[model samples]
Target chain A: MKKIIFGIAFLIFFSFLIVSAINMRTFGEPAYSEMDDYFIENAQSETGANNVVTSVVFDYRGFDTLGEATVLFTAVVGVIALFRGVKK
Target chain B: MKEMSRIVKTVTNFVYGFIIIFGFYIIAHGHLTPGGGFQGGAVVGSAFALLLVSYGSLNSQKFLKKDILSLFEGFGLILFIVLGFSGLGITFFYNFLANSGGWFGNAAVIGVNPGNMNTGGVIPLMNIAVGLEVLSAFGVIVLTMASAAEFTKKKEKS
Candidate 1:
């Protein structure tokens, strides 16, 4: 019974992944028609940075960057706390 | 795998040098290329990890210090926040003083490209801060793993 349930779950997961991969290939790539060009053009002016992607990540979406940094900080703290005092 | 011979070690060292240099190149050129802080920082961290593996951690300790790693981690976070706040009066992360036209043509006052490299806005500084933070974090992780492996090995020996 356990084996049957596990097999069914694995099958479903694999099937979903395969379907998504097939769809992605068929679609080739999704166009970001709304803000892609705008982002590329004015990113430099707005962010005062050369790289458009960096401008987008660090400046235009600074709140998100802060969140990302906080996540990294939390992970580091967690790791340090977990492995605090195991002498070699 | 069998033990690495002298010739193997020499070849690996050469490859490692190339990898480290290439990673720095990517990090430096991040502002112009597709790669940026996170990817380039990870590359550099991996380079250090390679060194730890090639030469034993005991030997690598001469170069990698735990205190320095902690310092870098703390400093990186502080620097990032400072840079962020420097733009507070304008917009957050705003590039203030990017177009001041240079104070007497010095690199410190005005940027080389105004909007490109040599711009002392938050971008380059942030890149470096993130790089340090990530490299230190990766070092800590690798150190933990190495210590765990050593402990397990000692247990098996006993």
Candidate 2:
């Protein structure tokens, strides 16, 4: 009975994934791309970075990167705290 | 945990330096390449992991000191925050250096010709900062976990 239930759940999840994949927008064509168009056109001149993705990451959406750095710092702190009792 | 066989050790010794250099290259070229700090850092971190696995955690501590790695991690995060705050005269995280013809301030070619390294304002700096933080963070985590595992294994054996 558990096996049957597991199989059914897996099938349902797989079908959902397949449906989403089939129905998803075409590659490189987003549903809303006004912002992308603007970035593509202006990022080089404004940020002076050839890679638009990097400009978006480090210049335009810099707060997110800051948060990511904080998260990583916190994670390292937590790991060190957890292992404080362990001997070298 | 015992160190891996001499073959793995030899291969790792031969390969880790190149891995680290490649990772640094990716971080330095992040503004012009597909990879950025996090990805490049992960590559370097994997080199540390490779070293730890081949040398064993206890033997690896001499080089991969947790104290120094922790210091670098903190330094990287602080540097990132400082860079972010430096742009506050205009706004937080502003590209104050771009197109200014100062350090890392050359205007990038309007379209793709050949990528310029000195073109991304605070981005390259941020990439280096984040790369350092992530690489050292991973080293500390792996080193700590490996030591902890050794401790647990010894306790179980006793």
Candidate 1 error regions (>4 Å): A1-32, B1-5, B102-116
Candidate 1, CAPRI quality class derived from DockQ: acceptable
* Candidate 2, CAPRI quality class derived from DockQ: high
Tens-digit lDDT track for model 2 on B1-158? 68999999999999999999999999999999999999999999999999999998878988889899999999999999999999999999998999999999999999876788999999999999999999999999999999999999999999
Report, to 2 decimal places, the DockQ of model 1.
0.28
Where's the lowest-lDDT run of ten residues in candidate 2 chain B? B110-119
Q: Best candidate per DockQ, number?
A: 2
Q: Write the per-residue lDDT of candidate 1 for residues A1-88, one digit (tens) a residue.
A: 9999999999999999999888673453555555886886666554455677876776677667767766776787887777776666
TM-score of 1: 0.75
All models, DockQ values?
0.28, 0.83
Model 1 chain A is weakest, by summed lDDT over 10 consecutive residues, at A25-34
